[model samples]
Target: MSTNLNQRLFNAADSLRSKMDASEYKNYLLGLVFYKYLSDQLLQTVVEQAGELLKEYNSLEKQEKLYRDFLEDESTKADLIQTLKDVINYDIEPDYLFHHLAKQAKQGTFQLNDLHKGFIYLTTNFEQFEGLFDDIDLTSRKLGQDDQQRNITITEVIKQLDEIDVLSHDGDVVGDAYEYLISEFASSAGKKAGEFYTPKMVSKMMARIVTLGEEDRKIFSVYDAAMGSGSLMLNVKDYIKDTRNIKYHGQELNTTTYNLARMNLILHGVDNENMNLNNGDTLNKDWPTDEPYLFDSVLMNPPYSAKWSSDDSFMEDSRFMRYGRLAPKSKADFAFLLHGFYHLKDTGTMAIVLPHGILFRGGAEGAIRQKLLEDGSIYAVIGMPSNLFFGTSIPTTVVILKKNRTDRDVLFIDASNDFEKERNQNKLTEKHLDKIIEAYTDRDFKDKYSYLASFDEIKENDFNLNIPRYVDTFEEEEPVDMAQVGAEIKEIREEQKQLQKELYDTISELTYSKEDEDWIKGALEVFKYED
Candidate 1:
């Protein structure tokens, strides 16, 4: 049933592809779906509260009418809304409900202004929801050349979303469905997707690795400095037993994506207070510079090789000061890693995705790598396959860093080849992820797949943490049998001799001029056996 609903939701997005690029159209489609989710939650809560409110209405139309009737009563309207606010900490008026707007759209009475007001009400009334709907441009000419056409387009989308029973299923299912839509948009967004989303398989892998042995904790905090869509942080929740006790901290440079991360967390039913999301550049500035700044786990997939203002000012910042040298301005991979690591608790685990260059790059990066290794802060380096990301095809490595690790050896897993090919992208399946998790948790060395490289071995190699230097994935070629080759060559030669003699006999049977026949026979002489 969830699969069917997900398809219908994606189809709605598909309907708008002719209007704009997936990068742009996704804002409208996802916005409405999110809006519908909020409205449905309110309506569902109302039904659950009133008990008799929706029980008689077998059809959505009747239920919506019933809701409209209930709201029309002036005596009960305020009391009902207050009750909803008390329960969910928010309320949507019946006039602005998703079903009502969808009904308006279905009847050709929908106004783009009405939807605009709904967005306005939420943003104006709530601080958390402020600027949330700013990305969904109802005024865009791309929706259509004019107002009525745009209304028709948005109307069609709302009506399509109306079919989704967002309240009939579990909140987690709805949230997962929302995630499905985000992923679909990400796939369509191509290179642009890196700005907002990470492939779920990778997120799951990092989540499992970071949450290992720490699953039973009553209160766990996870932070992502470059949190794209907040999926990585949410994955940490998936692996924890007490998900509700988890607090999420994230900062994104893109406002649109930050809004997406907010909606994602909210839909996942993360309490508003539990989400600490900021829309700003994580490198140029720092966030959560207050109480509870540190986290138990820091999971990140920052933009690879992205340029940052690595000014001398940042050297004074606590995050980068310890390294003595800064990550190169041209590649902020180490810079992001250092920031996330700084926010990690002494007992916390941090897993980050960076370009393979960080493993061996020289100069500033080399200096920083040496410091981390010397301090035994670097935990494990796992090399993942190329094209597993959305935009770039360069192979990436997940560098796991832990604070206060007594072990001096770093585990290296060469998982670069263990992925299922999915058309244009490489996917890490459950089996592939399980193998990596087993290897990571066991910390056991498997030849050609993983290795436990000691500090001495790393220093011997000039502190280069490249996987090839430690975990050798090279396959030795099978030994050749010279006698078998010689026998095959002899058999081929014997067959060739018989075939040549038969060819000469067949050529002798054909009629030709003497001069021409002699020329052909001369060419055939080159094919005769040596004997």
Candidate 2:
């Protein structure tokens, strides 16, 4: 059912693929899908709560008609709206419900203004959903050149979506389907995908590392300073025993992506009270300065090699002051790392994805790497294959950090060659991910694949964390047999001579003139035996 759901949702929105860019079209598709989910969920919740009141027409097939009938009663209408507000913290009018709108669309009576008003009502009255639909511009010419054309386009989408019964599925089917759509959009968005998506395989690996031993904890807190779509932090939820107790904290620099993260978390069943998401620059400003600033697990996949202000005033900030030097303006890789690390609890684990340059690049980044090694905060460096991400093809590494670690060695796993190539991108299959997780958790040496480098070994190389320096993945070429090679060459030469003689005899018989015969013999002479 979920498989078909994913396909239906994608196909429904794919009708507009030729009309606009994926990056732009995603806003409309995801926004409308979320609206349908909310409306359907609300209707189901109300039906369940007002069981006796709705018992007469409670059949699933008649749900929309029954809802309309129930809301028509003036006495029950106000009560229903009030009850919904008290229960779900918001209410949508019967006329604006997804079922009503979809019905109108099917009957060719849907208006773009009606949907716009619905969105405005939710964004204005619902604090949780405020600004959520800001990216979905109903008035944009991209939808169509004229309002009627736009209505026709949107109405067609609504009719297609009406085929899926969101209320039919149980237990995260809606959320899982939503995630599938996001991933599909990311694939279509190409380089723009970096703004709001992280490849699921990489997110899974980081989640496993950070939640290694703390699965049984009563309460676990996670943070991603440069959280993109909040998928990285949500992956941690899958590993925890009680996902409800896992508090999510994230800050995204992109406003659209910030809203995307919020919708993603909520769609995945995260409670509003459990999320601490903010839209702002993580590097220039420090957040979560209030109580419980630190987290038990800090995971990040910030934009690689991005520019930052690197202002002198930040030197006095607590997050950067300890490092003694700022991450350069051209590359804020270490800047994001330090921010996440500063918010990591002493007993917590931090995992971050960065470019390979952070391993050995000199200047401020080098100095910071040396200090981290000296303090034993660096735990493991796992090099990943190139083209694993959506946009970039450069090989990247995941550096795991921990506070107050007893181990003085860094585990280096050369997973650069571990991925399976798919189309234009390299993918880390489940088998490959499992292998990396095993190496990271066990911290044991595997020849040519992973190496446990001691503090002294690192010092010998001037604190360079390059994977090749530690894990020797070079396989010796197979030894060549010179005697066999020479014999084969002789055999090839004899065969060539036989063919040449055969060709010379055949050409001699076909020759009609002395000049032709000489030319043919000369051409054949070039293929004669040579030492």
Candidate 3:
């Protein structure tokens, strides 16, 4: 049923392709979708808890007795809303509910002011709902120059979203559709899109390796420093089932994307209490500061080679203080990694996506790599295929880190050859992703694909951890058969000599064997072999 539901939602998104920019449409449509889910979920809770009262009220209304008579003295509306708040931590008034607005829209009587009031009310009542609708503006000049046109456009999207029964199932239905919308928006958003989007296939692989043995653990926590749209963080929860023990912590730098990450978490059904998300610069001000960086699993996909302050004062910051050298100010890849690593629990595992430069770049980055290796913090390096990302085609690598592992060797997986071309971008199919997970799980050597490099081997090359330096994927050329080549050359010369004689005889027949025979032979000499 949800398969069809997802299809319907995507088709609805396609309806707006010509209406606005894909990125802009995502904000408008998904905000409506989120609003719809919230309103729908509230009504669903009311139905389950107050069905008897609602039915009685409806029966009374049909018999010429209005709802006022049934609820005049009881304050039934307030009672019901407070009841919902006790359980769901939020409430949507009757007039502002999705079903109510949907009916009004069908009759062409819906008011944009009503929705605006509702959104304002949401923030005024609950802190978590704040800024969710900030990115979505109904009165924006992009929507329309006048209120009437804007109302028409807004009504159409609300009606379309209302068509989706977000509360139809108890699974991640709404969240899955929400993720679909995010991915579609990112595909058309260009380089800026890479900031918040990590392919689900790659997320799955990272989830698997990070949560390998902890899948069934009753209590577990995962963190992503650069949370982006929170997809990577929530994706970590897909593997663990005991939600009671699940703790999610993350921080995003971009305010718009940060709001998106927060909405994504709630839409996916993760409770507010379970989430510890923050909107701040992870490098300058670390979130989860109260928790002291002890997550059981840490996942990150920070922008490649992003810039950071890298001030000398950071030399004293615990995350970088131990490394002996901070990452270059021009490239803060190592800075992001070390921040996540610092917060990781001794028993935790982390997987991060970074460019190949981190493996061999000299100066600060190289020193940091050497310190991590000597301390046995580096676990495995998985080379991803080029073009796997949307905007940039540069191939990236996923480096797995562990705080407590005793293994002194790094697993080098040359999975750069394992993706399929999808239109313009490269993607890791399930088969390709699964193979990487298997190689990582087995941690055994595979010819031409994976190699287990020891600590001494890394030290021998001056700590250059480039994949090609370890895993030999080179193919040897086949030796040529010189004797067979010589024989073939002789055969060709004999055939050429016979052809020349036949030509001479044909000429003799045409001229009665007397038409400038020597001249003809001399002219044909130009065609003879140089040797």
2 or 3, greater by lDDT = 2
Query: How well is each residue in 1-531 modelled by candidate 1, as lDDT tens digits?
Result: 577678777878766888887777767767777888898777667666777645665555665565666689998778878887777778876678788888888888989898889999999997778999999998989888999898888888887888887666553543355456545666565655654566779989999998999989999999998887787788887889998889999999988888988888887878888988888989988888998999999999998888988899988999999899999889998999999999999989999988899999999999999999999999999999998877667898999998887877899999999999976678899999999999998898898999999999999999999899898777889999999999999999889889888877776677788779777787567655555
Cα error, residue 501 of model 3, in Å, equals: 22
Candidate 2 lowest-lDDT run of ten: 170-179
Badly placed stretches (over 4 Å) of model 1 are 1-6, 52-59, 167-188, 482-531
Q: After superposition, how far is residue 29 of candidate 2 from its true place, in Å?
A: 1.5
List residue ranges in candidate 3 displaced over 4 A: 1-21, 50-79, 168-188, 476-531
lDDT of 1 at 153: 86
RMSD to native for every prediction? 3.7, 3.7, 7.0
Where's the lowest-lDDT run of ten residues in candidate 1?
170-179
Pairs clashing within candidate 3: 293-343
User: lDDT by residue for model 3 over 1-531, one digit each (tens)?
Assistant: 566556665666665666677777777766777788788666555555655454553321131223223234376866766777787789866677776787789889999999999999898899889887898887787777799987887777676677676766545553455556655555664545666777778888998888888889998898999988788877777788786668889899888788878887887767788888888999996667685458999999998899899999998888889999999989999999999999999999999999999999999899999999999999999999997765678899999999866777999999999888876677889899888988898888998999989999999988899999988899999999999999999999889978877775665555425567777677556444432
| TM-scores for every predicted model | 0.88, 0.88, 0.82
Candidate 2 accuracy as lDDT: 0.83
Off by over 4 Å in 2: 1-15, 50-61, 74-83, 86-88, 164-188, 487-531
Q: lDDT values of the candidates?
A: 0.84, 0.83, 0.80
